[model samples]
Target: MPARPPARPVPPAPPPSPRDRLLAEAMRLFGERGVDAVTTREICAAAGVNPGAIHYHFGDKDGLYREVLRLPVAELDRQLAGFDDPGLSLHESIRRFIQPFLFDDGSCNAQLFFREMQAPSPVFMETVAREVGPLFDRFARLLARHAGMEQPNAAIHQLAMGLQAMAHDYSMTRPMLDAFHPELLADDPLLEQTCHRLADWGCALVEFERQRHASR
Candidate 1:
């Protein structure tokens, strides 16, 4: 038998940099446990980097957590940014806002965001101003139009917040919802039906409020 040719040397895989490693591990840990429960030492250990790397890269542990929390909100903002067509109806607007959270496909870690909402920090407010507020403002305007209200009124503002709260409940209560309402998790058709139902539910409330104001 002929001798085999010399074996080729395989290229070594490039290791993730300290910053990237810290970010990945931070998100994983934060998702598993809320931000308050995680420590910088654990994050560095999980990422296989020096403890000081957190400060060097992100200024401190809080900064790192802020960055972690910021990730999904930024994604959500990008997802909703394109929903600016003037022709969108109230139900369509509500559906679009709710779509990103429900059928996320792991693009944005909805659990991480929900955790932040459960235990809010300064980062939560910062994220709101930076990424979330504008999206809500857009929804508020659309909601006002559908509700037959003037811009920036107390009614419209309250209604917009209520609409968002409804969407959040749908996203955060999935485990319980799945147990109680199997059809919602079974297929896209049922899921969409649920979404339409939710949107119509919101529109009905808005219409009622609008009519109430008109009657006064």
Candidate 2:
């Protein structure tokens, strides 16, 4: 073989700009502690940016908080919308709805939403209405159809909330669940089993409610 010349070195990647850094750190801190509890200084420090970076990039702390709140919901909405196919069965719909939050490990949106639920800010309800409410309504409609209900009644709302809680509780309680029962965290199989149980319970509960309402 002929001798080859040495290759040139590749340049290093550029650091994240202050705006992007600020947004990322703000989202993380706000997820860990509510916006009311986290300060601009802390976010700036975490991002390795100056204190003025928040004002420069986001206008103010509240502005950043609002962005942080909206970012996760927007992503989750995007993910759930992919499952809106009319042909999806009830169980499949439920799986797609919960899969992103429970199984997809790349995004911190689920943790952020859990934190928002724990200590909501002033814009919580508004954010939910704009970004998350439609998804919940879609799930409710699916549940109602699967359970053989025609109208939007109290039972539908309750079943929707039940399913939502079942899906959300896994993310919120995962740390505790892991600590107490590490076996559950051994691998993906356990998590899949847990999701199946949640789906089963949610489906059964909806049917039970349907029966109860029918007898009344």
Candidate 3:
């Protein structure tokens, strides 16, 4: 029998670097005009890639939105490694979570990260829960514990939702803060103040829960 010809050398596929690529573009556009104003063309323009790239890579604008949001979510997860603080003080755990979003020694990563969360899309919100739920849920239990609540209570999750609501109040209005309250919103000042405020707000709730838990 004749020997088979040598197999053609297969080239390794190009790197998807699209995650970072799309993220950078999404951040630029979303940060500039907010999410609704910026179209996929703008994202592609900022990204210096074809419009098809976004569709080819992320399924659609919403998919790209998920990927954009995921960057920070994944970053948060990395910083939170080994944070098995199911029993950690709720206020402190909340503080740790808030710190990453509010502060970054690096350049625009922090600011860009925050905009996505601040100006959420419905699509982003759908994925956001699944992506960030467990970590925040653990913090919910910690909050309940700090308030001396027993397991299986709805209050714990509600408290978690409250924390998000509060943070979102400040974070979602960040552009307004920067424009109308620039000094307070300066990254340095905001980062510093946000960390303390988040803890203070969280701790304040702990006291409220304590009373409620005791009353029951």
Candidate 4:
């Protein structure tokens, strides 16, 4: 047999760009410590870049924090795309809207969101209004359509908020669930079952509101 040729060594992977590093480190630090507690210097040190990198990449720490905040919102928007489709059944709409929360990836973005909920930065409300508010409004409008309202009212908005709170609870209370009921987290089918049950309840609630509105 002919001698085998020597294998060529693989080239080293390229290092993360300074911008990517800054974003990643900022996400970690902001998620763990909240934006107020974290500083530009700490983020730069963790990213292994100079403090100037933040300004170059994101203008400043506030700019970086805003970008970090948007990461999860972008993911949410992707997941929630088409949730308000007119062709979807009300149950499916509810399911689609809430499913992301149940099967949350538990990424750093989620932690950052939780941190923001607990202690929002100056940018948080503005960001939510600009990005997340439209999503919520769309869901509310869907609910109104099912409930026979010309538009979403205060009651419809309240209902939308309540459903969101329920979905968030399943994700946000995961740590407690893990400590007390580990099997719940481990069971995907069980989570799906719970999601379906919630969807059914949501449908019933909408029907009830529809009847109530009709009677008024």
lDDT: which is higher, 3 or 4?
Answer: 4
Which candidate should be chosen as best, given TM-score against the real structure? 4
Clashes of 1: 0
Clashing pairs in 3: none
Task: Tell me the tens digit of each residue's lDDT in model 2 across 1-216.
Answer: 988989989999998898888889877776666677888999999999988988987788877877777776777778888564779766777777776556535345555666667777677777778778888888787777777777657778877877777666676677788799888768754378777767777767877877877798
TM-score for every candidate vs. truth?
A: 0.79, 0.77, 0.63, 0.88
Between candidates 2 and 3, the lDDT winner = 2
Model 4 misplaced stretches (Cα beyond 4 Å): 1-14, 177-190
Error of 2 at 184 (Å): 5.6
* Model number with the top lDDT: 4
> Which of 1 and 4 is ahead in lDDT?
4
Residues 1-216, candidate 1, lDDT per residue (tens digit)? 999999999999998999989999998888778778889999999999998999999999878977887777777778786564678777787888876755534323555666767777787778678777878787777777776767746777787777767766766676688799877667753367767777898789778877877798
Error of 3 at 53 (Å): 2.0
Can you write out model 3's per-residue Cα lDDT over 1-216, one digit (the tens) per residue?
999999999999886575567778787676556668889988887777887988898888878877766777787889876544665555567777666554444344455545556676676677668888888777676777778776626876887777766665664566676898787756666466677778898788778878887997
User: What range of 10 consecutive residues in model 3 has the weakest lDDT sum?
Assistant: 101-110
| Model 3 bad stretches (over 4 Å) | 1-19, 82-91, 101-120, 152-154, 164-201
